[model samples]
Target: MSYITGFLTPVKTENKERYIESARKSWPLFQGYGATAQIENWGVDVPDGKVTSFPMAVKLEDGEAVVFSWLVWPDKKTADDAWARMQEDPAMANMDMPFDGKRMMWGGFETIFQN
Candidate 1:
């Protein structure tokens, strides 16, 4: 099974374009090192527990659109090893992160379905 790292975060709407451009630049950098990175932008059409079905997570003065992303690897061990090496890579040493890491939610997900 393929190993995957998932990242979920909020991105400033006004900064969305900039964020994606940064990601495009970064993705190839990782691909050169054998990691496949993919990004997705998410918008809430309804609050988590609401019934009226309205867009709740809009781009407010202090809020942002949610982003969900993933990094693909061949397997768990490969992912782990690659991540360790990536941490030590000088190319990533002083990277200017495209989003606010403090507000980001991320994790590894075990794949259960695929075509």
Candidate 2:
């Protein structure tokens, strides 16, 4: 089964273009480091929950939008290695993340089943 890294973040609505551009420039670095696939989605109809929600999870602010993303790797080892390498890669080091890193949430998952 493949390894996956999922991400959730709140990005300023006005910075959506900048966020997309940043992703475009960074995706290749991940691909070069053995990532098989990556997906980034901007929230369209996300609703707030009575007690908890995506917006609450990221401490979303006015003028900000939720972004959901994921990356696929052959396995955990490859994903781990790639992430470590990404930290040292100049392209990634120099790239700017358009969202608030402090509020970003991420995790790694082992795929147990897939159709």
Q: Residue-wise lDDT of candidate 1 within 8-53, one digit each (tens)?
A: 6667777788887777767876676567656565656525435422
- Tell me the tens digit of each residue's lDDT in model 2 across 1-115: 8999999999999999999999898888889999999999999898998899999999989999999999999999999999898888888878989999999999999999999
Best by lDDT: 2
Prediction 2 global C-alpha lDDT? 0.94
Q: What is the C-alpha RMSD of each candidate to the true structure, in Å?
A: 3.9, 0.8
Residue 95 displacement (Å), model 1 = 2.8
Q: Compute each candidate's TM-score over C-alphas.
A: 0.76, 0.96
Q: After superposing candidate 2 on the true structure, give the runs of residues whose Cα lies further than 4 Å from its correct spot.
A: none
